[model samples]
Target: SPTTANLLLPRLATDRAAMAASASAPPHSLLLAAVALAALASVAAARDENGVYDPCSDTRIQRGDGFSFGIAFATLGAFYSGGSVQLSPCDRRLSLASSGQLAVFRPKVDEISLLTINTTTGFNPATAGGYMVAFAGRKYAARSVPTFVSNSSYTVSSFTLVLEFNKGRLQNLHWKKDGCGACAKSSSLVCIGKQTCAFRTQSCKSQGPVDCSIGIQLAFSGTDKHESVLNSWYEVSNLRQYSLYGLYSNLKDTLSGQFNKFF
Candidate 1:
């Protein structure tokens, strides 16, 4: 009864808060658009995207699967952006760099971690899914390392970071040695060291002096007998370089076009 009470209470509270939040915030499609446009929008919401009913305050996310989840901002860097729900799962644990107050999580949920992000990828809060720095020192940062979300539990794992980056340049970096989909259908990827590995990779691959950028991505996690999808739209606001600008715009346009064409 206590366990059920604990779960139910949060749901009730969240339901009320979500109702209040929705009454104040924009409509669901616009909110979704805000989440999608985060790559480009300078201002966005601070609430966790995965906490409420994604479509609106009324749509409740089905939790209680014994999963741990939360969102973190770069404790050390620039402001965070975006306003949509991108659900990512991790092997639970967090550090200062990855530290944001735990906004949305199920209590006593097992080893869902928060460290592996920077280990395999860099931190870009505007994007959806890299591990926000929970801990950072002069040299290294910790992130959501996998194992918790894998086949060890119900015999499945989905520490899915379904994001897009420069394909041409990413291949150049030595991005190896991180948890990967152990199955044949899964692909392998590694996080680069903090030197903007994607930047180096993207820049070198280009013919002329150009800059490229990566936008709002979602790092999501959940476990079920079925699969879930998180759709993102990015509108570019600022870029690191001209090369970065072109890359962001191109990816945004193409992805937006493709998403609109089908849906």
Candidate 2:
């Protein structure tokens, strides 16, 4: 009864709030969106793209029969908080760099053009059967790292960075060793000192001559599933390249994109 009560209460409360809000709404567009979102909390609602009704407010996600899931940012260097989401039945995991809030997750699969605009392969949800999911960070300074199992095939075609401070800059754009030492070329990626190791034989690759003066570019690679770490820091630290420095307390931001199954 407690579990049932728990589920029913949130929906009831959400409905009440939606009704109250709608009674005094201003803009048609805003009111329409609010009503559409509230409808998702109903028990009679249909299943979402992930094949589950309601939302994944639950923290833990099961492997669900070893189904391969993935995340592609609408833009690179998007902001998210700390803690990682385990993609069970596999060594792969998704990390929210700084915040731990699930900001946006669509219930149903919808066709969109953003996926195609950025990815070279031109992924469309109508064709790919993938849905969008997103997470946001606190308001100040943070980074997002969607780390995957090294050697696991993936592509980071395009993503957007929603930085709290407009002056924020792309700090690092390279793969680093989960192990110690500067991951030299053609060397075995060690994990003795690190929490996890990179690909078996993959080494850290740098994006040479990045022009922040012009804009940020998300380097694309098809074969590497190495831990691609992207760091975001205050631009005022022009000379000092330190992760410890230039950190903030209340950084608010979000990043969204699709996790379509790649065939």
Candidate 3:
């Protein structure tokens, strides 16, 4: 089998060499033919002694030629910034119970919308809240992060979703529909900085002084009742470190619309 697979490599290598030689203006047809041949070769190589190919074989090679998964189009400042933060379990279901809620990040979406449910009346999208999208900046010092801390840890353990803006600034978002309207509407929304802040990381320290003329930080309590919880984060970097295909197998069906444009 190894010898058989090796025998097919010469043609692919020759095609690649030819393409590189004519990189300036290779014929489109040639490119398509090469791609098709490569796919066929991979399928053939991934077959077993029984001549049956494993459709989902890990040995198969599929180049991610034209795919674009980049988010965070723009950075807040000159430093490292702008790119979608990934979450685990991208397709979390909504809770229908009286005390149920779910948080999901739509890959390639622009806005973050939160919907609320009233136990007696049911779900209310009208009362739901939304925000212009943003990504959380690097966590500096614990005090520098903008998030709510429950005075009574017993009532609400603690939760945070911080987004960064220009000048090393940060804000916490709860990803909910209602509440937090005033903060989003205000041009000069007052926020608690070093005065009243908590760190998500245990060993939090200040990177530097970052100024944010306008930002949003919405607070919510985890202790509050919810029907079911599907809190997960997606890490885009994981795709490459591990096997590529299975990384997003679960999300392929549930993922919707253009990744950059979320409803």
Candidate 4:
């Protein structure tokens, strides 16, 4: 079979090359070649299973290192309305339901941070249902349950997405609501339904000095599959979760300076 033959090519080539070299090589040289060949074969076998690079299948993240993944934003209508179980965001079949906007972020573990996406023209989420999902991992495909970001009433600017890991592998992702408390002190922020702080799309720029950009803060928690103990990445980092406003202020100042270029 073509598939079987393709899979065996690496081993076959190594065997043939080794046989040709054995005639001139000493015993130790032959032994070293055999070891090298075995290593190559093992690597090939591993790659055979790994196949192409799919962000959904990525499970390699070092302890103390930040992770990278994608976020898809769309209207409620963009998702399947059927009663069937929700599919992983990384599923190719999801293209039908997720032909919306995607934003990728690589955030350090346990760090409270903000990311802003500026548009040349005004940004509006009202046309869409203003929902988003964060997703990563393959064999352990993890997707945060859908979260509402905007509507005709308001657009959320601050959010926290927690990544859960167990045994060094990502297990799940979920949204942690701030109940608008993080933005309570700032006169510039508007609390929406007490679930989030948002900028009213109609008067976002008029209500505050800040630009109308979407911001998300990331964190990590929980343990991986079937684990009782929580992952230490979040706890050990001693994150100041409320620092999101400070970070947002810095980002806003920097963005304001270059507002002319964006517009």
Candidate 5:
């Protein structure tokens, strides 16, 4: 429930996995609690600052809490965005494979991160590629509202995981991971945008009930002046849990870390 401090809502946008023999936690849980407390305490004190919330919202952003199914944070210029984009059994057009589903959006060209979520668990090896959305890459359109396309990708006939970033402006912004604040992948040392970029397949093969997380930062070096800490992320396993208590705990933890990056 979005009302629960342990928000259970939207889900993915997959990339890879952990490195440390005992990988560090994504810091998602601790932060969610903090946000809850912040919203609660400040609701009366600094209510003006937290303009996004409404009088009806007794609690902060939780699962199903309006855009709660996905990400809580949006770029400086954020408008309408979010949803549980899923695919059907008959849609064989999606390149993803069998019964492939997705969740995607593009509020703007600079707004790269999509507060992505994942519902399936690593146990289901059936899940191979990831869900995806298409972006208009054309730079001129004002209020360039990026629309949601297909939902599934099993035995595809066309495209999947494709984003048409304005080729004109994106001429210089290629996928390169140069160990700056973003570069984390052991192999792809080139950072995309300001953050890091990495791709690993072996990162899956899980050990136990562990949440696998991967984030890619979109470095914006364009003329549009923007701050760092572009975005943070995590994908879920559908096989894992859709029920509130089961998935909300992990989902809150994921969003918590993402929110922390903002501060």
Candidate 6:
């Protein structure tokens, strides 16, 4: 019945009714549910022989095409043990428990999108663990360096995640911090401890806002599978550091307003 259970994972993650049921499910069922929800976010773009989408396959992504993927947030103990780190969240050795969470985002190739994750109860990176992993297919996965999400003084709300591809395959995922430069200058934002930009929870809207949700500015870099040099999307965009905040805010508002029904 493992296969049947796996088939139910996505529903448990996205469906409110199923989610309520899962609160009382067994531990193993919860683990599969977490993995299923994370993996299913992106699998709709590709599939294997069984007509099931395997997140481990090496699929080619074309320019201008949109694809979905997941980011898993867990404690250091869940991902690292014996003084070593797990490469992929898909590994059987990894245990994704209730303490862990997943955020799914669908972004177009060569374009930047603002991705948000709603944590109704509020997420304390210091306590919940600031580690995250970005994964698509099994072969296209990367763990981010531990990012300090919040401290007693402030909570950093915005970040930039760069997906680097080489020859049409994902090579690495990088998290770039702005060192609070943009936030310090913005009249609407605040700089936290001179380390990062933050949004005050009081200033955020109850429905959805950067302060209430984790916001990631997603962008793609590197060459596609074709290995062609003519169309370098990253280079064409010419993204500057200071410009990122404006772009992130604009996209965040547009997406939140347009897709609030689903999220």
Task: Give the candidate number with the greatest lDDT.
Answer: 6
For 79-143, candidate 1 gives per-residue lDDT tens digits of: 22232322121222222224332222222211111111111122222232223321111111123
For model 3, give the 10-residue run with minimal summed lDDT. Answer: 31-40
Better of 2 and 6 by lDDT: 6
Q: Order of all candidates by TM-score, from best down to worst?
A: 6, 4, 5, 1, 2, 3
How many residue pairs of model 5 clash at the backbone? 36
Work out the TM-score per prediction. Answer: 0.23, 0.17, 0.15, 0.63, 0.27, 0.64
Tens digits of per-residue lDDT, candidate 6, 1-263, equal 01111111222355442232222221222212221111111112322122112333345665655444556666666766454866555554566655665554445555545555544334445445556666655545555554656444445666677777777667777777666667656555787667677766445544335444566666777776567431323532455454544644554455444333433
Cα-lDDT of candidate 2 = 0.20
In candidate 6, residue 129 scores what lDDT? 57
Task: Give one clash count per candidate, in the order shown.
Answer: 48, 23, 24, 6, 36, 6
For 132-174, candidate 2 gives per-residue lDDT tens digits of 2222121211233543322222212222222121221112123
> What tens digits encode model 3's per-residue C-alpha lDDT throughout 31-139?
1111110110111222222211111111111211110010111112211123232321111121111121222121111111111111112211111111112222122
Model 5, residue 230: C-alpha shift (Å): 13
Superposition-based RMSD of candidate 2 using all C-alpha atoms, in angstroms: 20.6
N/CA/C clash count, model 4: 6
**Positional deviation of residue 8's Cα in model 4 after best superposition, in angstroms:** 43
| lDDT for model 4 | 0.50
Best-fitting candidate, scored by TM-score: 6
Q: List the candidate 4 regions with Cα displacement exceeding 4 Å.
A: 1-54, 64-66, 81-84, 96-98, 110-112, 119-123, 182-189, 205-210, 222-241, 256-263
The true-versus-predicted C-alpha distance at residue 163 of model 5, in Å, is 8.0
Against the true structure, candidate 3 reaches a TM-score of: 0.15
Task: Give the Å shift of residue 99 in candidate 1.
Answer: 10
The worst-scoring run of ten residues by lDDT in candidate 5 lies at: 37-46
